[model samples]
Target: MLHIRVITPASRTDEVLRIAADSPAVVNVLKLPGAAFDPEGDLVEFDVAREGANAVLADLKALGLKDTGGISVEQLDLSISTAAEAAEHAAPGDPEDAVVWEELSARTAAEARMTWSYFAFLALAVQIAAIGALLDQPILIVGAMVLGPDFGPVAAMCFGVLQRNVRLIGAAARTLAAGFAVAIAITLACAAVSRLIGWIEPTMLDDRPLTSFIIHPDRWSFVVAVLAGVAGILSMTARKSSALVGVFISVTTVPAAGNIAVAIALAHWNEVGASLVQLGVNLAGMIVAGIATLFIQRLMWSRLGRHDIAPHSPEVAAGQPTSGRVSG
Candidate 1:
């Protein structure tokens, strides 16, 4: 279930109330007229089934509340109302399978930003992976995978292609390129320091048994990446974020990049070549798999009449703001 709060202008309060009253998915409707101070309007609240939230939000947007006032939505952690249960039972489709495109796009787009913290996390993950590679520790490699922040830009690019948003694609590309570059450079420096301190022995790279996974690229690596990509995107759309941890460790993205940095520092040209291939294969597989999964999800939802997202305009495709678009 989801809780919705809408501040409606005086002229449209009745329309908003009517919309809420008519919707079978809405329950516990409350109206407080002349209560809002910010655009100075009525405050309307309701509980709606998660399966039907996108429809209600679309209706609210059609009424222009997003422009005249504002609409806020949050998941209801606890709803004790029998009416809410009836609403959920009455609403068609499973809430777990629902994909709110506007929310997902906005979220992934935000995650694609090239902030200082983003770089720090990526670089730190790579450095950690370097240590894992040198020590041939699977646990540390998995830890680096979990700490890596590279998935955001890849997901953003997939979202951009689905929405045909050129600016999102551009921003994600630049952030990804810069992120990998910075992470690799930082990992290289860390590898040099480790060598200077005699922390990384030459035999670590030569007789790497447990760590060979990071530098080896093959069909299995691509297959795992594809599976992880699908699982990752599904976890995001379904709001089952705990599943992302599995996705994080299922592929060797960060570890491969880290191996590349360490191998270059140690002058292991063959290992460097293999690690580069591994990195490229994993990244390509994830991006392609993500795009395919999201496309299929949108198609399936639209066919079921469960998703009613508006078609993107030219401005929206360019990543410019649209009038009164509501997202949370």
Candidate 2:
């Protein structure tokens, strides 16, 4: 359920009240006149079922209340609500657990930001991959996957496309490209240093079967990538962060890219080409799967009556200044 607060001029109070009263989803409405001090206006507070929140919000928006006053829609956390027990005891398709697009987008964008920790994680991932290649160990390769930080921007890109938010898409793409470039470059340099120290042998690359995990490409590779992408998205949205650790372990992009760098430095063209193919396969699979998963999720949520909320729109609340408006 959602709690909507609208501050409107006394003149339009009737119109606003009528709109709220007419909404079938609205459960209770309260009007407090002269409730605010600065730019004083009447406050109309109301509650609506979660299933009808999007529709009610849309109707309120169409009323242009923001232009005349203030309007805000806040989600009521189910945990603290007096109705929590009832809500919890409800059936599986409970409206309270319905997906909210605005919340999802905001969370996704915030998580997508590239930070120092992200770089640190990527560096560790590359190192893990290099170690795995040097030791010809599959466990090390899986560890490298678990350490990779590439999923953030990839999932962000999928969310951005679903929301049609160009800025998000651009930011996610830039982060992804920059991170891979940096990881690949660092791995290549490390490979060079390792070669100088005689830590890696050219013959080892051809003899190691485990190394094929990063270099070999097959149909199953795409299937794994797709599964990882779905899991990645679910991990983010459902706040099951630990699931992401498993997702990393399932993708080979980081390992393959790292191996490609190592192969290049060691002058192993065959392995380099093979690893490059593996990297391509993993990347393509993740993107396709991620986008498809998001689409399906959105469709399911929409069918359950959740609609997209345009947070970036310029529309204002009634009794509030339309121009120079700022959201808190």
Flag regions of model 1 displaced more than 4 Å.
Answer: 310-328
Q: Count the backbone clashes (under 3 Å) in each candidate.
A: 0, 12
lDDT of 2 by residue, 291-315 (tens): 8988887677555533434344434
Q: Measured by TM-score, how close is model 2 to the native structure?
A: 0.74
lDDT of 1 by residue, 37-150 (tens): 999999999998776676677767767676799988888889998988888777667778877665786788898889999999989998899888888888899999999888
Return the number of clashes found in candidate 1. 0
Instruction: Evaluate residue 123 in candidate 2 and report its C-alpha lDDT on the 0 to 100 scale.
Output: 76
lDDT of 2: 0.72
My TM-score estimates for the predictions, one after another, are 0.91, 0.74
**Candidate 2, residue 286: CA error in Å?**
1.6
